[model samples]
Target: MEQTLRETIRNNPKKILGVNPNDAKVSLSYLTVAFVSLLIGGILGMLQGLERAGLIQLPSWLNYYQVLTAHGLLLLVVFTATFTIGYQYANLSHSFGGLLSKVRKLAWIGFALMLIGVVMVTVMIVLNEASVLYTFYPPLAAHPIFYIGLVFVVLGIWACCFGVFINYRYWRKNHPGQTTPILAFFAMGVFILWFFASIGVTIEVFTLIPWSMGLVETTNVMVGRTLFWWFGHTLVNIWYLVATSAWYVIVPKIIGGRHFSEKLIRLVIILLVILNIPGGFHHQIVDPGISQSVKFLHVFMSLSIAVPSLMTAFAMFFVLERTGRKLGGKGLLGWLKKLPWGDVRFLAPMIAMISFIPGGAGGIVNTSNQLNQVIHNTMWVVGHFHITVGVSVVLTFFGICYWLIPYLSKRQLTPKMNKIGVIQTYVWTVGMALMAGSMHIVGLLGDPRRTSDTTYGGHEIAVSWIPYEMVFAIGATLLLIGVIIQVYAVFNMMFFAPKGHTEFPVAEPEDDATPAPLWTERWGLWIVLLIAVISMAYVVPIVDMILNAPPGSPPIRTW
Candidate 1:
């Protein structure tokens, strides 16, 4: 019976079809580092949350802002970016049969560079030499090593991207007229986005490296920020795209359904590529130096990208409904009850999807020029992201890890532990609900963000915010509990779980009525479009800032 099950899994069309077992271990090398960064970053984040609650005091040696910076860079940059690449390799293995020597070598190069950079930047943060926060915009420069380390990290990623493309190019040559495997398409979309998005940061960091090293005395703060946001806003969408790939490509099969439209999936990826770059300008709406026309353009463009998300929501419903009805479900929403809620794989992404609904609304609010002014930089902004990236993206990733860790490590995720994974998801969702919800309300109430002490003016309105803070503290504690369990489950799966095998499950997609278009494969055209849109939105602003910019501020490490 066990052999039959293994054979069935091996023969499944939608399953991760890949090469040697050794290739999987190579892919996991990157994932291992990512998990390590996530754990450390999560711990720092909990410390930050507790300090906010006044539950405990961090050592004077470890300042709040420094911890904040570490938390942001480690999780957002180190963990997410590395994880995306590793997962790309995993997905690639589904098509390539296994990684070639070049691919493996490049993967290791990327990993080494990233690990070294992370360690250097981390040490700098611990010594309080690089607390410019994650943005690190000048004239508040970081240590030279910090900026240089970032450059190494970016180069590492680019090498990995190069490796993926090489395999892709080779694959296309051999499989002419075949639609690229969906998993392969997913990887191309992700790395193409990364390739374009990294351009801005590459330039931004190069500029900072010189200044940090004292080669240039002054740097335009405006240009620096403009460059960073050009990179920053898209970074959020990159993570979104990564998580959504799993949702779109594998999710249907999870519920015993097929993709609704392969063509639609391709369109969604294309739209994200073209629309997401222009959307970055929305992040800079509040800056006095940026043009109103540009910000307005960004508002519409950013809002435009949200349409694909809406499409995803509907398609997901259709898949769920169809699958549930086939499984004997009935009524308007009864199919939802028929979902495999007990499986942590489904449960994690489900909670993430549910949480993103509110987060999406908050994004619209933030995009508005006038509306954003009302809550900009308040805890509302914090709450919004806590829901979006914090809850949605992070939860999805953790959920993926539940299956991924065991599959990659050849460890068994016991039935009992699967229940523990599900519990962790709910605990996180509930805690985020309380924490992020209160943040939105308090943000609207005008509580400032990124500050340690809340006391000010001593007015009644100011005093009223304390209860929410206490509630937030309670939520934070609950969230940390979930984090602990999630991390423990991961390490348990990696090192201590009984040896066993689990397949990388791929769900059946609903048969598409319309065939995927040939143009969807024309990645070059879309890449050109992406470049054009980004340049159109940013070129004038960046050039204008450089030609007639404000004086650069000198570096400061003030707490």
Candidate 2:
């Protein structure tokens, strides 16, 4: 009987057993770091908001720019990256029955390298030795160590990327004539984008290292800025793609319904992967040296991303509507009422999906050439980012947490904790609404971003911005409260939840639906196309920036 049980467990590891304890530990450790970073970054965000509103004066030992730099790095790079790795690895492990031992080792190595890099970067930020902000844009150089730390971060990401590749190759070789599992497919798309996205930034950083060390007198600012945005803007979509994975596969299961057409889903993923990198050009729309024709062509490339986005939106809606109607929901709008609104697992992501309506519209505005010029450097762009990332992406991540953490920890989410999560979601939504909303209004009034002070010696126009700034302070306070509650909930779920079996929540397709075609798995062809598209959009402008470059500037430390 014991031998029979062992064989059963081996045959159905994910179901009969659960996530391997070793594998669970790897994911949990990464998540712990992610949430901790969120806590610190949240505090810094609150400080920046209050200081910007003139509600408090910062001490000499710390400055607003320093806080800004740390906040961006902690939340954007550390928090997001760690969370993504943790979640994706969990998906990979569960979908493939279990991760290989070697893949597990690579994950641990990746974690250690990331920790070392984060420490180096954080220490520099705390000591005020590096305040160049998250973009690390050239001409405003940071400490050489800061740049070196970033190199480590990239290396860590690459290690994980290679681990995914090896595991994927092994899976395909072992199971020929079968399509990859859907969740695993999404994971591949994610790491593929991650690996390619880092390439430009990696090159830019290598150049900066020697320049920051004074081994070179100057470095090309345009090239550096372009490279950073190549990674930076694509980073936003990487988050979007991660969120969509949940929307596609996880949410349907939560609602007791099947997913949309597998073919359509794969097509969306393929389109996104092929067209994403070139979309970064819009970030550089206003910069010089790039010709108008190039910018015009890039505007189209930037807008092309919306096709996949719209495809995602449509697919999700179809699933929601179908599920609702099947559950006996009636009327044109009654299907909405059938959703599991009381479940935090559903509520958080529901709001996230809804928030994207306006968030996506805001994105279209930012991508338009003339429209971008109007709000390019204003608080409006900040507001747009907050709404899109804070609500759409982070909230989706929050939703995943309620289930994912419990699943990995071998615990069940209690009702009381669900209530707390629901409350946290609403609090975050309202806070972001107030904060991001006011920012948009004030930005249109000409309030600039990235400035420590916009008072302009109390000029009437500047004075007019004060009331909105105060709104920012209030919204920020609420957001901090939300952050604290969320951190508490994550830890509680991780270590203290009731011991029980929790489902991994993967959805299946309808019985009658067609299987996803094998052609969709042609990743090599997709990658070659990605390279071609990137070349078409970047080659002319980037070559112009490098070959006809201006006299490069020395490091200028503003703060």
Candidate 3:
């Protein structure tokens, strides 16, 4: 009787109309927070660039590290976190027809908690009580309220994660024989990763709270750092997974092509989730306390992530070529000319994919023990993430905004708006290239990062870095322009654009594609495997750090 009712409700004509307006409010609210963060973060980023170029001096009330901390926190944490929640919830709503009312309430509750957290953290930063950079690595402590703010944020994320799980369970029970929509599957992967990846950081933050309150005298820096990166590097892959979802499901639709094998895509998601957390160990390669042999092992574990990445690259290229050929291109390379280069939907993510080539290569260098020694502490490291996250992940997010905002708002993507987006994409690409390229080169020339001034009394080598620093300022200026355009475009589309329908743009698989095995849906088995992998990678080193611990350091404020 319940099954029959579920089927009837699912097939109702009104259910297929569009996203539930109530659900759209949840997503749009999160997106609003996201773009607002982007605007502020972008401004902070430009200030850092100008300061690094020695073009402007900040007032006494604000220091370089404060700006750095705020910039990283806003864009990296708040912006990305809010955007992912907003976007993924929309995916869940679309895939399941509509979210459960309870789930919608959870979304709003999560939003409120996160907003509270962001407010607290921002206040601490403003008061200069927390300039602890985004990583918030320990011994360098912030006010206890900063850690408390982070707790609220994590709690908020947990709320959303539970909501997704509930929705997934409900859908599976209703449609026993069917695979969940590909986007929902991706959403499951995203929130699952989110829930688990945050565990280490939650533990870290709980420890920090007491020490920051002077309840504990000292905290172990090694343990704190280990815990942080366990979450930190996984956060990187979480964004990658989010971007990959679009590449696999949405981009193909935009390009008029079928998605690659469903089985392969699911396999990729599983592999990424299991292999991801261990890869964070590589970020700690330069730090001591971990044995050299373990670090060497972690190098391989980190590189293991590249296998699925390569598979994705291959699959995407295959889809693009096949689609272009179908659109009537004669020669081997001529298919490239047949793509929709003018479409912002395709153009932004295509460039994002292209940027990952260099980004991925740089990652390989960062992972290698010998190679990492040279650049680990340099601006090259910053440049690497700038291209990886800044372009690859962020540009994809920018592309998503064009269709998603309009769809949620029941508005059209006007030609004029599309042109603005296209120009914004180019401007951002050029800006990131100039800034990241110069950072990489100057890093190789031995320019250090996190230091406000490297002039060294105008030494010859330092003097040489001035030109590259100037380029950084110029790139930052253009990026600010891009940010202004993007934020303006988002609000305009959400509010003022003409009323019309927009498609969600999920691609279908090829006709002859093999059915994805039901075994892939065994999320329990996958989670077990993920835990096992994490244990193998972390247990030994963490045990060593705890057992052979030094008397830890007390809180110290550098600023």
- The most accurate candidate by lDDT is 3
10 residues in a row with least lDDT, candidate 1: 11-20
Give per-residue CA lDDT, model 2, range 468-539, as digits (tens): 999999999999999999999999999999999999999999999999999988899999999999899888
TM-score of 1: 0.94
CA-only RMSD, every prediction: 3.1, 1.4, 2.1
Q: By TM-score, who's the top model here? A: 2
Better of 2 and 3 by TM-score: 2
Which runs of model 2 end up more than 4 angstroms from their true locations? 1-8
Question: Order the candidates by TM-score, highest first — what do you get?
Answer: 2, 3, 1
- Candidates in order have lDDT scores of 0.82, 0.92, 0.93
Stretch of 10 with least lDDT, candidate 3: 7-16
| Candidate 3 lDDT, 171-256, residue by residue in tens | 89988988888899998899899899999999999999999999999999999999999999999999999999999999999999
Number of clashes recorded per candidate: 8, 0, 0
Tens digits of per-residue lDDT for model 1, 123-190: 99998999888888677778999988888888898988898898888877776886777778878888
Report the Cα lDDT for candidate 1.
0.82
Roughly what TM-score does model 2 have, to 2 decimal places?
0.98
Candidate 3's displacement at residue 53, Å, is 0.2
